[model samples]
Target: MSRTPPARFTRPRIALLAAGALVAGAAGTAAAANPDTRENAAAAPGCTVDYKVQNQWDTGFTTAVTVTNTGDPAGSWQVEWSFAGNQKITQGWNTQISQSGTAVTAKNVSYNGSLGTGASASFGFNASYSGTNAIPTVFKLNGVTCTTGPGGPGGPTDPPDPTDPPAGARVDNPYQGAKVYVNPEWAAKARSEPGGSRIAGQPTGVWLDRIAAINGVNGGMGLRAHLDEALRQKSDGELVVQLVVYNLPGRDCAALASNGELGPTEIDRYKTAYIDPIAEILADEKYSGLRIVTTVEIDSLPNLVTNTGGRPTATPQCDTMKANGNYVKGVGYALNKLGDVPNVYNYVDAGHHGWIGWDDNFGPSADLFKQAATAEGATVNDVHGFITNTANYSALKEDHFKVTDTVAGKSVRESKWVDWNRYVDELSFAQAFRDKLVSVGFDSGIGMLIDTSRNGWGGTARPTQPGPTTNVDTYVNGGRYDRRIHVGNWCNQSGAGLGERPQTAPASGIDAYVWVKPPGESDGASKEIPNDEGKGFDRMCDPTYEGNPRNGFNMSGALPNAPLSGHWFSAQFQELMKNAYPPLP
Candidate 1:
């Protein structure tokens, strides 16, 4: 609803012509209309014009100017705004309108020509003005005056309902008995675990709770720390410590050209950022009962544009932490830390099967993510399987927007940009990913984490809420439930219902979900839009795939300072925090 000024004038003669017509028909209509209708009409001789302006939030405005149809036909009118003062219009739209030194005018749009007595057609403009004054009154619509609509920024109202609600919301879950995971800060300074709920962070059993398991032995800080917290506060082991991780160096496939040849110190940076963390986790004795994971985002490495084949494209590209990249070296590095990384499962993203129906692109992305995880040192237990439809996965289960379309091809468009399909058939595609993992020698304990974040009705389409409900039982583990994926609004604005973890995956293998990214923080935008080509809006954008895709780019106010501060992101996180763990019971 970001409105720009009218692109030139769609028409400038509307008001003038209608003004003359009104003068001619004024007397005639005065005698013809019903007595009551005329009685209620303005009891004036000359037309009184009321002009106003506004810019409504999210949607455009309706410059409702009551064009008193002082004539007949109820059509043809010209509206003009002569900026008598220094006021100016920056931009506008929706009419054959034009402007001169001070006047901005709008003619009746071609389709509808007339406005009978009392009838009026509303037209408006989204403009930027200067000096402290509204438009002058000399401007008229067909010389006939009219009443104005409410004026102000989008007409004196609260801002549009942003995606997130500022104060924490009561997103009461429909699934009462399910396990769930709250954010990191909530886990850190917990007063106590709620009754009947198990903590999902670290299981006190063996791998994750004690300081040794997470710190001394297995060293990674982000998730290992989160896992540990989940374990320490579990009152009844009922809390489903959900976490999500989509760490793509560059959202696209062509992130790194020649690891050794390109940058000055890629490997060292990789170890410091990605590898060293996994190494830390390996040496921990507390690696036993935690739901930690190394999820591989398919087609998610922003830099790997040409590397589109499958696991092979991602497999060979090693994360030479010994060098200087800021991420953990590829799977090989993590694998080197095995034994200690136990119970930590991995999920390769299977770009939703919606792509399968389109061209089978996502499957390979999933395969590559797994391949990379395996290369990094993740085992069958740590990197068990894959998941799809995470955030805008082009899946059919769009619980958010009810993704259906007028396009006759499939139920929806492939995607707004790429030709890849966006609608995923959850059951069929889940089975596909499951079968793929199973076929890949993953016999006993392997399954996929169907990102239930955007799923709703199975078919057709409608306004689906209840955010995203999961179905772990039907697809895997006789339904014991495992990890699932979802979003908590990286920008951290309020309204996004984040902590409602599903109650399905309650076993050892199918680990609980985790929020890998610090919500409110950005993964980065892709190199698509003008300001965003070549480089990423964030590190997680996979133009060819779901690089933690953004539903829309909402530039609220000023930008944040750095990647660390993530100003907006933090604000949103604070809002989410307020919601998930409000002060009251």
Candidate 2:
């Protein structure tokens, strides 16, 4: 059997700094609130606004406003209000604040943008006021005037407690009884190390772990071990076991740090030695009650498509892989054999939003997924969903960045990459990708899983919350945080934090958001070590190496002396906890 080189995987491009320097915009003028405008403030539309003065001084005052969406599920929103006096907002949080004359507009930040029906989100601002600090009467949501009287249509007479979940929304998963497995190994590792205690506050206890890498060279625990573990864990109420099937000939393409020991000529050995045994074990009748969800061959099929440009030079193994068609053969075999088991659910890894999030990319990516599904006797039904941002952190939301295309004369940031409207965050990308898959004949019910594990590193430059900005780079660099030296640098990146906790039914078009890559696992070693493992050092891991074309990043910001990919890195773990978004308790 001809073993082919494994396909390569790289991180998405980090924020590409604008060619021109950021031109700072004007700051709003200081003003005093006028008593006359206080009575004019009235809410309109299907929303209501409650503005309160949290603090007041002679020249400036602080206020917090709660905007409640009583109409529908608003994935994004804009709230507008005019000042009654000379009040001008100087700063704000949890919103994108903009001011013109006395008019003030606040747009939702990426994370806080989505408002379920009857759901309320709050933001606060500090403003300089002139003579009188009078509240403006006019308020609007998405341009419709808000009402100060009884709430508008579909709104509750009494404002629902802001802390309560939205009334008319199914904000959580419908499959209430289903629980995905959390690998005990990761938790054990965390507790044994420094900053491990932070793991207790995160979703680490609930995250699904991957059993990767059945390269022909490494010996793996037989199916018996997997089955026994799943059976034992099943008693704890987890109905499904999550396993990552990630051994391909020429694994990880020519990417040295992640190269699997399996060579391109090992297809026969791959099937007989790996997939066949794993499938036979999963199919056992005794383990029938355990639902096995296998993330089949990540970075494999996707690489065959992404690596066609002759860039990111593929290893000779990958060349044979393409020439011999071993990857497809292997994935087809795995999917088909695994699908044979009634208890198994297979989700082909689709890389992440950064990898295939572009318009030109998702369609082909979906087609590739479809191809994988149809390859064997395995039909689309044999595949359950697509996993994205697996083991990668491309932000859940990019709140501050906005772009206007010079040629198209439209906000390119708002185009396919951005959906032509809302800021293109991971959620938006996942939702769109899910729809594209459906259009291409995949089941509409096909759900998506996002690895929120390490993607949460908002860079040190990130604002505590969104505020006013006109310069694109300033807005992006200051308001949004992503610590990657470059987007393509995927190793143990610097400044990364834990992303959203594991959740089911996070939003429509998504089934479950998982932590497939457990937090604390190093993407790769910071520098070459004496370890004898086949994993080689990619210069991207060297803090001193400036950068390269394939991944224009030197990874100077990465954790130093980190272990090889998938091994423990204590410093990175500690940093992740320190920088976690929701702030580890």
Candidate 3:
């Protein structure tokens, strides 16, 4: 809900106008209205329960529970559950809730208690917990046990639906198999640490033993090795492995650390060398059920918008990238090829809130993504979602704001250039961006994936308490959103902490919040250290370096003399484990 600035872009105005009118007919409304339902009944008469960890901070959390009746019509219903940990339900919605120690009970509200057999109802609550915010295990509808919706029978969990499911309902996540492959390279490196933070009292390595990862194109193990690893992990049933199809011509223009080996002229090589080979293997019939979620380029398109205009600084490579049409062409080529594969889910990179949160940037960014998809011979169906904050840290919530801040004359909330318009945090930015994308011709079912790798670093710098502030600056500095040194700091930041663990059923409008930038993996080194990977060493990683005059940013709070991006840094790992919000398990 961005304010209408004095000068507004015509395209965004038109898009927003259409969006306002069409939003009611959008997909999220239906999905939210009807939680996932099944033809078969639950153990107690086909009641399905979807438990989602909605929002979480350091100690407190909010959860959403959707209970659907797939059996006979019920005049009234009661949902009961027991907390796995020492969880206590403090407040609830959509029902009358009461808690006694570990046991909790919720009777439907007068409007929703009585449900038709196929209809679904949802309610949520806010609660506090000290440690181990595990989801509740057992749920009963009127004393009858309710089966978990999709994750597994063992737990009452709601995994995100991967496909374009009916509105409000998500496709069953592809990563629901017994074991998903976490790149052994990263896991082994972290575990090999003789000493560092310990997980479950064991070394940090134990925690990453079975995590998931993507085999990136530029610096990662090649496609063959990644495919082989997927095959190895796919012992019996389907195997789901995440892969990043980066390394387009003019790979990363704004930053040097990630500049790729490909140049503008190497577009053919990108297709033949990179995307085609990968697509060929993924399309193999033998690997039919293998799910490959490929995050298409990062930092490329945002640079086209933000890096230009001489704001932060523009890059010549980006100019060349646009001129050559390589990025859009390469992305289009990848999507056209990859989309043909049945299991491959292509999520084009949509730079996070910091880059495109404003009204002008938001609409254009959606257009850029659409143009890329169109150039790549992709239909609306070819793409699944747009990933935000890829390999970057952007806060999930905005804790402070004032109604008066929207006033044009008396507002400190406005940045120097872009008006602080509608979005207050990454969540709002994402939800708004999703709507914008749908307006710009993407599918209504298109989901959003946020890379929440290092954003959960809430501390005294970020707002812990809220009250009236002197001005918008105080409101923003002490309250508004995000305590990151700067949103532009993409390198290994000093104070960053681990965000939410990779999860499926995220807040509404988000398909999955993934750890695209695997924790403990470096964003780039501070110094030009030796590395086998063919990544560039930019001065941005060096805390001692002066600054990138073009981007108009200083490397504030960056780790000095660190390892090259993607390498394990034990010190940072220990720091992340130490400051992890919601306390990592």
Candidate 4:
């Protein structure tokens, strides 16, 4: 996506009357006092403010403020206040805060900008003061004055409905008991195709692959438009809107065909132009009720592990990303900003077992994930979970043989197809990797999403049972469900098929089996055709080009005559339907 100018911030002075005093204590210890709560009176066509001293010490204190719009809905909002004492803010979260003299402005970030009527947004800051930390007598929303008085609309006394999920709060499994939004645009295309109606109604991810995609690319639906559609489809029940947060500076650095518009060093542009805007839209109050699951930066972090640091498969691009640290920074920034929206769940893309299930790649990739998750002011908590096999054709389960299977005194790992990788399929890899991620400090409750979109391997070639124990190589190759030349041949693979339909909690540690990669989208052009999307031609996408070390020097195995990455490929779609694992009836 082309970079756009940074968004200009508007500062409007509004005021609310809030009064409080902080008790002094020892230099390092918190003061002994109950938390202080301050409220603002109702203002017609205005707002209310709830300011509280959450914690305090002898020289430092933290404060939380909630602003509720009692008037008409606002597309974006800002809350401003002043410090009566010498308290100076050290840092803040959940809002973009800036201080000037005694005045402070807490502006909404991308996600929290929308404030519907009676909707409340909260932010907090830590400050240091030599004297008493006095709550300012005034608070403001936009330019309106909030008077010091009793609680008004959406006030402390007016409790929220117990049955409703708290504004921005996350559920254990968003897909559970919720309807996933079916993209009308994709559905329309599917319905236009013969026999496409069978899976046309299924939910697939909306790829925000560029900055242009946020607003709408070439007059297509934008992020807000999709959310609005999701709301309309929600009825009274919960709904999940899947989003592929795929744009990063120098994205997909290990390969071509998916190179991003931003150069390797353009991390700042990535923040200001790409991630920030998307965060703003997701934070908008108009879409708060919808469960938004963001698949963050596919094909990124895994490259840092398997394709960098002088590895045989290493590319200069991957080396550049590792050296510049932009990949980690970009992913971290995306997680930190996007995670602030309570209802948005972030699932970082973990490459499939074929790429990183080897002993050398597995643990290191998890560590790298931790590094990215914690970078740029992000904590592990920012990540809701991890997704595997996104946009790749990795079989969800190799039911014919196990990784532990041995044939003629040889383990399955000895087979050329298995290549000593510890996993036989995406499901086993995802489940095992979840434990590894938790071992490295992620929350244990974290779930895994398996992209079963094109990994079905269910055409006439799909093996129904284990092959004869002739030899390890012959047995493994004959019975393996993934029909690609090699696991690493990851473009528009020939004979690839649709995998599992979208479902929830299909197995242990699995949150959902999702079609995160929409069927019918080409992985890349079959040849050198190119345009302005910053996508380049990769030989791996070519039908006959010899492979690199990444794909074991095998034939490309890609279908012939494809389009650029993300463009529709009609022949590939028809092939996917013809080979759909469960067989479209």
Candidate with the greatest TM-score versus the true structure? 4
RMSD of 4: 20.5
User: What is residue 354's positional error in candidate 1, in angstroms?
Assistant: 7.0
Per-residue lDDT of model 3, residues 47-93, tens digit only: 66666654444456556566767666788888788887877776665
Q: After superposition, which runs of candidate 1 have C-alpha atoms over 4 Å from their true positions?
A: 1-228, 235-265, 268-277, 286-291, 294-329, 335-340, 349-357, 366-370, 373-382, 389-422, 425-428, 451-500, 506-585
How accurate locally is residue 92 in candidate 1, as Cα lDDT from 0 to 100?
A: 33
Candidate 4, after superposition: displacement of residue 173 in Å?
Answer: 0.7
Error of 1 at 100 (Å): 68
Question: In lDDT terms, which candidate is top?
Answer: 4
What is the Cα-based lDDT of residue 98 in candidate 1? 72
Q: Give the whole-model CA lDDT for all candidates, comma-separated.
A: 0.35, 0.62, 0.62, 0.80
- Report the candidate with higher TM-score, 2 versus 3: 3
Candidate 4 TM-score over all chains jointly = 0.72
lDDT of 2 by residue, 515-542 (tens): 6777777778767865555677877777
lDDT of 3 at 140: 75
lDDT per residue as tens, model 1, 233-342: 44342333333332333222333210121132343443355445654653366644333444443334322322332433333343332122323244334334432343
Q: Could you report the Cα RMSD, in angstroms, for every candidate shown? A: 23.4, 14.0, 10.4, 20.5
Candidate 4: the clashing residue pairs are 14-140, 15-139, 15-140, 16-138, 16-139, 110-280, 111-283
lDDT of 2 at 180: 48
